[model samples]
Target: MDARPLLPSNEPDVASSPLAVRGLTVSYGEKPALFSVDATFPPAAMSAIVGPNGAGKSTLLKAALGIVPRLSGTVTVFGEPLARARSRIAYVPQRASVDWDFPARVMDVVLMGLYGELGFLGRVKAQHRARATDALDRVGMADFADRQIGQLSGGQQQRVFLARALVQDAALTLLDEPFAGVDAATERAIVAVLKTLKADEKAVVAVHHDLSTVPDTFDHVLLVNVRRMAEGPVATAFTAEALQATYGGRLAVAQLDRVAPR
Candidate 1:
């Protein structure tokens, strides 16, 4: 697969980045998941966080969003603390992490995205419903809006979740393994939606596992292994040396060729 065109040579200013983390560290009890990790995801770009299993890719996203407790470090959204910028961010946890059995319809899940604006006691207005429907349409899940979320196929459910995130119209959208367990058609649909988001100048960051798609799917990448290993345009940071350092000996020669071909 060919790499996408690179973003402008001039990197975004640190403070202007959609998401920025400095000295971030996270631990569960005594086991450290990430240490002094720092990363900045630029606006209007698609970035992938890739590493081996247990390499802290998910931990980095969780810690940066304060979903998991952090041992140290600060996370900034548009140069401000998370609290001041919370409304501008939207997150989609891994599909495996969600309890799909919950008795909610697809539309109900999408509307939840507006909870911040519509107070708990507030009513859902016509405009709100319209936005929710539009989001579902964008992900090609509009027909399933009334269907029980648990009844949909894995790819369909993922599309519904993406629709939910779209309703928020967030400036920075964070997703955990969006392409996991999906069919080829679903993956193509999701990639198209992500590119539309980028075209609209929204920042898209996802924890991705399919190394083969990185070059064709993302504009920038962050290679991690409990710490920041390499990060920049895919052409520069996604090198054989960096991949070797990040994955160690876990990647087979053939797999390595697919990711960073000779």
Candidate 2:
């Protein structure tokens, strides 16, 4: 497993394996989401996992997080086997997957970030509350800490989710569609927050859809459509052919702007 920073920051990213997948295969009943997928996540970098809908983007992340069963392959995090490093990874699921009407307050949800270490029978302690508040402050959501999740805007809800992930204090973060329905300004704010994570030397990967923003925001990209089409540096793997392959041969990328950096 290579731990080096995948993207070159202002200074060259030194290597330290953050996450690695080798021959990873995942299936849901008879259908397969990933097939023999092999990849590595560079430390301290933001990686865009781009793919059309149902291309197994979420499945791959789930497999990595041990939420879904993987038919084969191995995942390792921070130089330790994934199962052994479970406590160091944070996952922010899609907002659409949750019920905002559940009636939980933002601060309460954020405190769940500490539940992994707190044991199932234990309730959130005072220290956990402090950490949740700190995370909300970092995301500029301190004022809305006491608001019910249902009352928040889409962007505000997303920020709360990010705060939850941050409160985990994990070394690696996986976000599924964090920018999907947010406003442009919200998108910018989220991207800025992700950049801050890189500065702090944490690896963050997002399941992204917008093609125009990939180059400007991501350093590495995993182009997927059902199976792995290409995985490499953004500039090389996000080429016209790669885009077409990942888009299921529907996009006329050959005539599209090829000058964009991957």
Note the clash tally of each candidate.
Answer: 0, 7
lDDT digits (tens) for residues 163-227 of candidate 1: 98999999999999999999999999999999999999999999999999999999989888888
Cα lDDT of candidate 1 equals 0.89
- Number of clashes in model 2? 7
Local distance difference test, candidate 2: 0.81
lDDT of each: 0.89, 0.81
Tens digits of per-residue lDDT, candidate 2, 162-203, equal 999999888899999999889988889889888999999898
Q: What clash pairs does model 1 have? A: none
Stretches of candidate 2 exceeding 4 Å from the true structure? 1-15, 121-126, 258-262
Error of 1 at 104 (Å): 0.5
**Residue 11 lDDT, candidate 1, scale 0-100:** 48
Q: Compute each candidate's TM-score over C-alphas.
A: 0.94, 0.88
